[model samples]
Each structure stands twice: as structure tokens, then as C-alpha cells.
Target: MEQSKTNQFNVLAEKPVGSLLMQYAIPAIVAMAASSVYNIIDGIFIGQGVGAEAIMGLALTGPLMSLTAAFGAMVGVGAATLMSVKLGQKDYGTAQKILGNVVIMNLTLGIVLGLLLLVFINPILRFFGASDVTLPYARNFMSIILVGNVVTHMYLGLNALLRSTNRPQKAMCATIGTVVLNCILAPIFIFVLGWGIRGAATATIMAQMIMLTWQLRLFSNKDELIHLNRSIIKLDVKIVKESLLVGLPQFLINLCACLVAAMMTRSLTTYGGDMAVGAFGICNRFILFIVMVVIGLNQGMQPIAGYNFGARRYDRVLGVLNKALIFGSVITLTGFVIGVFFPTPFVSVFAKDSPQLIKMSAHALSCMVMMFPIVGIQIVSTAFFQSIGYAPKSIFLSLTRQLIFLVPAIFILPHLYADPLEGLWHAAPVADGLASVLAITLLVLQVKKFKKQMQAPVENMHTPL
Candidate 1:
């Protein structure tokens, strides 16, 4: 076990930046992409099997889902990041403690939030632009999802830990397994059992539970470097503070996303009605597919950057960042080309029978991706700051796209345009373009600081002393 642990550390420290990224990023990218694909598939099933209103209902649930993910990312992303840095510093004890705290925090938050959301589910959905027609489908889907929220939280928290603990492949496999399982069970539940939207939700939670079980078993192995210990399972004050502080940016991003989704849904509901909201939902799923790929790249970059930064390898940290930026740019640009030119085909996949839905979705998708070519830079830069323990910068950057720019654009844009829906569709690209500029500025400043840090030792070596 000791030798195995040493080798893992050595690889992170010694591996070439490009190869290391491929080793790490590919699994994560595969996992994220597969997860997104599953979402697209689930959307297809709901749209075809349930009804168009069901699709709108699913869209209405976006805000709630984002709220759930906000809490999960707070513990999961924060702890995983802290653990990665601890391992780089050779602080195995603290890293293990982080794992334990993650379990406790996820359980506590999941239960409390789940119960609260369940109680207020109807009102919340109504606030998020659910109409009389769409309310039942949204309520049915979210009820089942909220009930199994603890499972979802634990599964996500543990997977983040797996990546930080040198088990990226394992983390990847867990996500892929869940996605595959969901795909298999969704059709059965929705079609055979005739559960409709409720069936899709049931299939999702069941798949997550199965994978969560496997994750727990893996952590139970005492031979692992960061396995669970009953003695350390209790929360530590310092660890909890650090985890939350580190995870706050992600938490805020998701929280703000919840608000933004709600705002967008309400705006769409007002201007274009329920079908407009459904169109946004379809566009969102497709955009998520692309964004998830970028996220996968960031996940791949996280440990590498975090570990090297903790080790004071400024050059390696910067190396990974540059590579990630380049890769991220390419990915988002691809999404841009496809969305701009061939959106009809993709949108048609969801609702072939509904021409209005397809046309609205296609136009919205194109508008949303108008600034995609530079979107990757903003995403990568935010993750870079977070990986290096710059929580303030990370949090600010997270807010730039969602809260600072996007929120205001969503609000003011609609009133400016004669066609309110067109204004809403344009809000995203406007935010994207502004946020990318800010990200580039911050990234340049940070890079210069790292470069100076890198040159410091060389300058000292050349001195008389």
C-alpha cells in the first residue's frame, strides 16, 4: 500500500503535462460526456414517452436540481480539492479525514435540503414558472428525485473524492455505470411499467443508488490510502471550514444557476408560454452536453493543477492550465459550429412530432452558443483559480457569468427587444462574451504572477549567496 501510494504521487509529480492530462482528462471527459448524453437520452424519453408538457415540467425542475447540486458541489468539489493538495504535501492523515467529513456533510445537507424541498416542492415549482398543465409532471418527477437525494449527494461526493485520491478511472467508471444503468432502466420504467415522468426519475435514482453502493464498497477497503476510518468519521471543525471555504465558489455558482434558471423559465413562460420554457429545456440539455465536456476537462485539470501548486511546481501548474485552455476552446468551438449550422437535426431528436418545439429550440440553441468559442476560457480560468486555493477569485469568476452578467442580461434584454423571447435567447451570448473577457484578463494577470514566481528561484540561484 505504501509503495502504491508513492507511485501515484510520483506520477502526478513526474509525468509529462500533456500525457498526464490525457491520462486524467480522458476518463473524466468520458464520464462527463456520457453523463450528459444520458441526460439528452432521458430528455428524449420524457419528450416522446410522457408528452411535451412533461418536457416543460422537466425544464421547470431545473432550478430545484441546480439547488440540490449546489449543496453537493460545496462538499464534494471543496473536499476533493483540499484532499488533492494534502496528498501533494504528503499529508495523508488530513486527506483521510477530509474523506470522512465529506461523508458526514453530504448526509446532513442532503437530508435537510431534500426534506425542505419536498415540503415546498409545489410552491417552488410554481415560482419557477410551472403552469397548471405542467405542475403535475414536475411534481411527480421531483418528488421521487427529492426522496433519493441523499443517495445522489453521497454518490457525487464520493466520486469527487475518488478522483482526488488517484482513482480517476474508478470515478469515471462509476459515472458511466450509473448513466448506462439509467439508460437501460428508463425505457423499462417509462414504457413497460407505464410510470411516465415518474418512471424516469425512479430509474435515475435507482441507478445512482446502485453505483453509490459500489463506491461505498470501494472506500471500505482498508488497503486504500484514503479509505474510511470509523475513528475519523466524525467531523473536524477545521476540516469542515476549509472544505466549505474551498467549495463555496462551486456552491455559489450552482446557487446562482438555480436563480438564473428560474428567471429564464419565468421570462420564457411570460413571453412564449410553456412551450418556450420547454424549448429552453431542450437547448439547456444540449448545451450541457458541450459544457459537460469542458467540465470533464476541468476535472482532469483540477488534481494536476492542485497537486503541482501545493508542491510549489508553478511551471507544471501553468503547463496544465494552458493545455486545458486550448482543449476547452476547441471543445466549445465545436459546439458553436454544430449549434449554429446543424441545430435542427439535434433539436429534432427530442421532439420530432412537435415542429414548434423544434423550431424554437433550434433558434434558442444557436443564440445560446453564439459566444461558445470563448466560453471555454472562462470555464477553465475559473477552475484554475479554484484548483490553486484562490477561493475569492474563484467565487468572483463563478459569479461573473451567472450572477453579474447573465442575471442582468436576462432581466433587461427582454424589455429592450420587440420580440421578448428573442431578447431572452440573446441574453446568454451577451453574458458569455462579457464574462470571457473578464476571465481572460484575470487569467493573464495570474499567469504573469506565476511566471514571476517561477523565475524567482533561478534569480536567487544566480546571486552571490
Candidate 2:
């Protein structure tokens, strides 16, 4: 166990930046890519086997899913960031406390949120602008998903916690396992079982359940440094408070996502109706895939930056941030190029038979990611703050994109343009550009602050006789 801790420290604290990043980021990217693929896989099967309206129903559930993820992030990301810093400080006891808190928090939030949503499912869907044709589909899928919400939360939270403990490979394996299981079950359940949209949702929760079981086993091992303990399982006020503080930024970011999705659906439904809503769903899936790739890079950066910062190794933290920015930018640029130039093929993958939906999605894809190249820097900067425990700064940056800028633009832009649908598509890039600029300014200031801190001399104290 000590050797394991030493190796983690050595790799995170001493390895060459480029090599260490590749080692961590590759697995993360694969895991994130696979996770994103599972989302797409559901869409593909639903669109191919079910109908466009079915996809729209799935789309309506975006806000609900985002809401669930928001709380899960609140627990998972919070605890994970805290754990990384604790590990760096060699406070193994606190790290174990965080692990216990994670399980409890996830279980509590999952049950509460799931039940609340299920109880109010219909009214919520109606408020989100779900038409009569799509309401049943949304309810069907969400009902099953809600039933297994605790499983979903536990899996996601544990995965993040695992990565923070320098178990990125293990985290990657869990997600990949879920993805593979999802792929197998989705087809069988949807097509062979003739269960339709509900089958897709069922497959999803089942896959998560299986992998979460595996994750629990890993944490239950007595040999691990941050393994589960019965005594630690009870809540600790300080651990809970700290975890929530660090996680608030991401929680709010996802909360904003839920709002933004709802707003887009409402606007799209108002102007373009069901097909338009479906088109946005396809576009969202593709965009999420790209974003997840960048997130994978950020995940790789998080532990390194968090640990080094805790250890007062400012140079290492800065090094990882710069490298992460470059790699993330390259990934986003690739996404932009593909989304702008070859969107039809991608959109076609989801809506092969629905030409109108394809056309709308293609246009939405291009417009939404117009500022894609700059986004890597923006996302990385926010993540950097979160990783280093600058929760307030991270929260501010996250809000700049989703709430402060995008929310207003999404509402105002459509009204300004003749074609409201085009305006809706345009709102994203507008927010992206504005938010990226703000992120750049903040990041520059942060870098300067880091430099000042690095140059400051350490205080010396003398003992008096």
C-alpha cells in the first residue's frame, strides 16, 4: 500500500510532463470517448429502431439527466478534488473520510432527486415544452432511468473518486465496461425484446449497475489506502462541507446545462416544432462527444495540478496547465473542423431518413461550435481553478459560459433574427466567444498571481531561548 502511494506521488510529482499527461490522458480520453459513445449509441438505436419523435423525447430528458449529473458532480468532483489535495499533503485519513462521505452523499442525493423527478415527471416535461407526441416517450425513458438513479450516481461519483486517487486506469476500465455492456444490452433489449425507448433506458441503468458493483468491490478491498470503512461511512460535517464547496462550480455548471437545454428545447419547439427539437438533440450529442474529449484531458490535468498545488509545487501545476491547454485546444480544433466542414455525415448517422432533421442539425452543429478552438482554453481554465481548490474562481468562470452569457443570448438572439431557428443556433457561438474572452482575461490574471506567489520568499522563524 505504501509502495502504491509512493508510485502515485512519483508519477504525479516527478515524471516528465508530456509523458505523464499522455499516460493519464489517453486512458481518460478512451474512457470519456466510450462514455460519450454510449450516449450516442442510445440515440442511434432509438433513431434507427424507434422514430424521430422518440429521439425528441430522449432529448426532453436532457434537463433531467443534467440535473442528476449536477448533484453527482457536487459529490464526486468535490470529494475527488479534496482527496487529491489530501493525498499530496499526506493526510490519508482525511482522504478516506472523503471516500466514505462520497458513498453516503451519492446515495442520499440519488434517492431524493430520483423520487422527486418521478413524482413530478409529467408537469416537468410539459413545462419543458414536450408535445403530446413526445411526452409518453420521455416519461417512459425517464421512469426507468429514475428507478435506477442511485446506481447512476454511485457509479459516476465512484469513478471520479477513483481517478482522483491516482486510479485513472481503474476509472477508465469501469466506464469502458459500462459502455461495452450498454452496447450489447441496448440492441437486444430494444430490437429483440421489442421494448422500444424504455429498453434503451433500461440497458443504460443496468450497465451502470453492473459496473458500479465492480467499483464497490475495488473500494471494499482492505489493502487500498482509501478503502471503504464502516466507521468512516457515517457523515463527517467538515468533509461534507469541504467537498460541496469544491464541487459547487461543477454542480452549477451542470445546472446551467439543464437550464440551457430546457431553454433550447422550448425555443426550438416554439419556432420549429418536433423535428427542430430532434435536430438539436442530435447536435447536442455530437457536441457533447467533443466536449467529453476535452473533459478527459481536463481529468488528466486535475489530479496533477491539485496535488502539486497542495505541495506548493507551483511550477508543476503551471506546466500541466499549459500542456493541457495545448492538447485540449488541438482536440477542440479537430472537432470544429469536422463539425463545420463535414457535419452532414455526422448528423446523418442519427437521422438518416429524416432530411429536415439532418439539415437543421448540420446547421446547428456548425453555428454552435463556431468558437470551438477557443473553448479548450476556457474549459481548461475553469477546470484548473477547480483542481487547485479555487472554487469561487471556477464557479465564476463556469457561470460565465452557461448562465451569465448563454442563457441571455439564447433568449434574446432568436428574437433579433428573422429566422428564429437560425437565431437559436447562433446563440451558442455568441456565448462561446464572449465566455472564452472572459476566461482568457481571468486565466491571465491567475497566471500572474501564480508567478508572484512563486517568487515570494518563504518566511523564517527563529526560536528564542
Candidate 3:
């Protein structure tokens, strides 16, 4: 068993960087792409089968969903990053402890956050710009989603551990399975059963619940190096702190995203009404598909970068970062081409009967992705810092686009334009451009520091902020 575990992790340190990236990244990209497809499909079903109001209502739920995901990412991303470093250091015992702590933390946080959101869901939806017509749909969908929040958290957290433990394929399979199941269930519940918006939420939760059960069984196998054990299942204060600390940047990013979504929705609702909100929803789903690909690439890079950095393999770390940035840029640039030049076909899929909705969505989609060619650098740089456990740098980079640059742009830009809606559409690209410039500056400096450190003796070398 020990030999098998050693062989599994040894590849991280020994494999060629290009092949290793392909081996890890392809599965992750497929999984994230599949998940995004499900979201897009869900939007299609709701818009076509229900109404435009329903689509707007769904958009209103984005803020709360982001808020829920924030906590889940905090534990999952943090523990997984930490676990990779521990494995590279050959500290098997600590890695096992991390696996145990992840399960406990996710369960506790999930239940607590779910209940609090459910209790005040009504006011929350209203604050997110849900109107009389849209409020009921949003409320119904979130009620079911919140009730099954623990399932979502456990599924995501366990999947992250699976990737970090040299089982990226298994993690990918789990996500794909859930997405396929949701795709099948959604149509039946929404169209056949006439459950409406509530049905879509139910389908989502049920799929995640089924997959969460499978994930639990996988972790229960004692043969695995990082399997769950009753003895180590108790929470350790130190592990919890480190995990949350490492995960804080992602937490803030998502939390700030929640705030940004709320403000954007409010502005859209005030200026352009419910159809405008629906247009924003359509644009968001499309952009998310492209962004998920970049995130998947980063996920593939995380273990490699973290493991190599822990082993003091500066060259390997630099290699993976460069590859990731290049691939991420290519992916986002493709999105830019498609969104700007040919958005009609994609936007029309959701609301074919509503010509106004399609036109509005197509324009919004183009404006939002105007600077997407450079957006990947910002995302990849933030993830690079996070993977290496440089929490302060990661947190600052994460906040730059969402909180510092985007928030102000969203507020002030609209007032400056003759058409407030046009200003809102342009805010995203402005933030994207400014954030990417900062990312490039920081990355260049970091690379220079790494080069200087490479000249020193290995034993005396230390990671500096």
C-alpha cells in the first residue's frame, strides 16, 4: 500500500511538465465544461418552458449561490492545496489529517450557512432586485437549493481532495456523472411534471446528492492513502486555521462576487427592467462557460505548482505557470471571438421566442467579453499565488478586479454615459483590462525573485513574499 501511494505521487515530481499538464488538465477541463453545460441547459429549459420572468428570477439567485459556494471553496481549495504540499514533503500523516478535517469542516459550515440563508431568503431575494413577479420564482428555487446545501458542499470538497490525492480522473468522473444526471432529470421535472422553477432546483440537488453518496464510498476505502479514518476525523485547530487561511482569498472573491452580482442586478432592474435582468442572466451563463475552462486549467496547475514549490523545484513551478497562462489566454480569447462576433446563435437558444431578450443578451455578451483576451492572466496569476500558499498576495489579486476595480466602474461608469445600460455593459471590460495589467506586473516581479533565489544553495533557499 505504501509503495503504491509513493508511486502515485512520485509522478508529480518526475513527469515531464507538458505531459503532466495534459494528463491532469484534460479531465478537469471536461468536468468543468460539463458542469457549465448543465447550467446553460438549465437556463434554456427555464427560459423556453417557463418565461422571461423565470429567467430573471434565476439570475436573482446568483448572489446567494455565490455566497454558498464561498464557504465550500474556503475548505475545499485550501485543504486540497495544503494536501498537495504535504504529499510533496512526504508527510503522509499530515495529508491524512487534512482529508479528515475537510469532511468535518464542510459539513459544519454547510449546515450553518444553509439555515441562515433559508431563514432570511425572502429579504435577500428582494435586495437582489427580485420584483413582485420574479420574487416567488427566485424564492422557490433557492428554498430547495438551500435545503440540500450540505450535499453540494460535501460533493465539492471531496472532489477537490480526490484531485489533490492523485485521483483527478475520479474527481472528473464524479462531476461529469452529476451533470449528466442533472441534464436528464431537469427536463422531466420541469417540462413533464410541470414543477416549473422548483423542479430545476430539485433536479440539481438530487443529482448532487446521488454523487455525494458515491464520493463518500470512495473516501471510505481504507486502501487509499488519504481515506477517511474514525480516529483522525476529529477536527484539529491548527489544520482548520491553516486551511481557512489558505482558502480565504477564494472566500473573499466569491463573497465579493455575491455583492457585485447584487449591485449589477439592481442597476439592470432599475434601468432596463426584468428583460434586461434576463439578458444579464443569459450573458452570465455564457461567460461562465468560458471562465470555467480557465478555472479547470488552474485546478490542473494547482497540485503541480504546490507540490513542486514544496519540494523546492523552482524550475518546475515556473514551467507549469507559464503553460497555464498560455492555455488560459487561448481559451479566453476563443470566447472573445465567439461572443463578440457570433453571440446570436448562443443567446437565441435560451429565449428564441423573445427577440428583444435575444438582442439585449447578444449586446451584453459582447460588451462583457471585450477584454477577455487579457482576463486569463489575472485569473491565472491569482490562482498561482493561492496554490503556493501566498495568501496575502492571492487575496489582494482576487480583490483587485471584483472589489476595487469593478465595483467602482459599475457604479460610476453608468452615470457618465448617455445610456446607463451601455455604461453597465462596459464596466466589466474596464475592470478586466486594469486587473490584467496589475497581474502582469506582479507576476514579472515574482518571477525575477524566483530567478534570484535559484542561485542560492537549496538548503538555504526560502520562500519570500
**Candidate 3 lDDT over residue span 227-306, tens digit each:** 88898899999889989999999999899999999999999999999988899999999999999999999999999999
lDDT of 3: 0.93
The best candidate by TM-score is 3
lDDT of 1 by residue, 86-165 (tens): 88878888988999999999999999999999999999999999999999999999999999999999999999999988
> Against the hidden true structure, what lDDT does model 1 obtain?
0.93
Per-residue lDDT tens digits for candidate 2, residues 361-399, read: 898898888999998899889998999999988999988
Q: Could you estimate the TM-score for every candidate? A: 0.98, 0.97, 0.99
Which stretch of 10 consecutive residues in model 2 shows the poorest summed lDDT?
456-465
TM-score of 2: 0.97
| CA shift of 378, model 3, Å | 0.8
Clashing pairs in 2: none
Ranking by TM-score: 3, 1, 2
Number of clashes recorded per candidate:
0, 0, 0
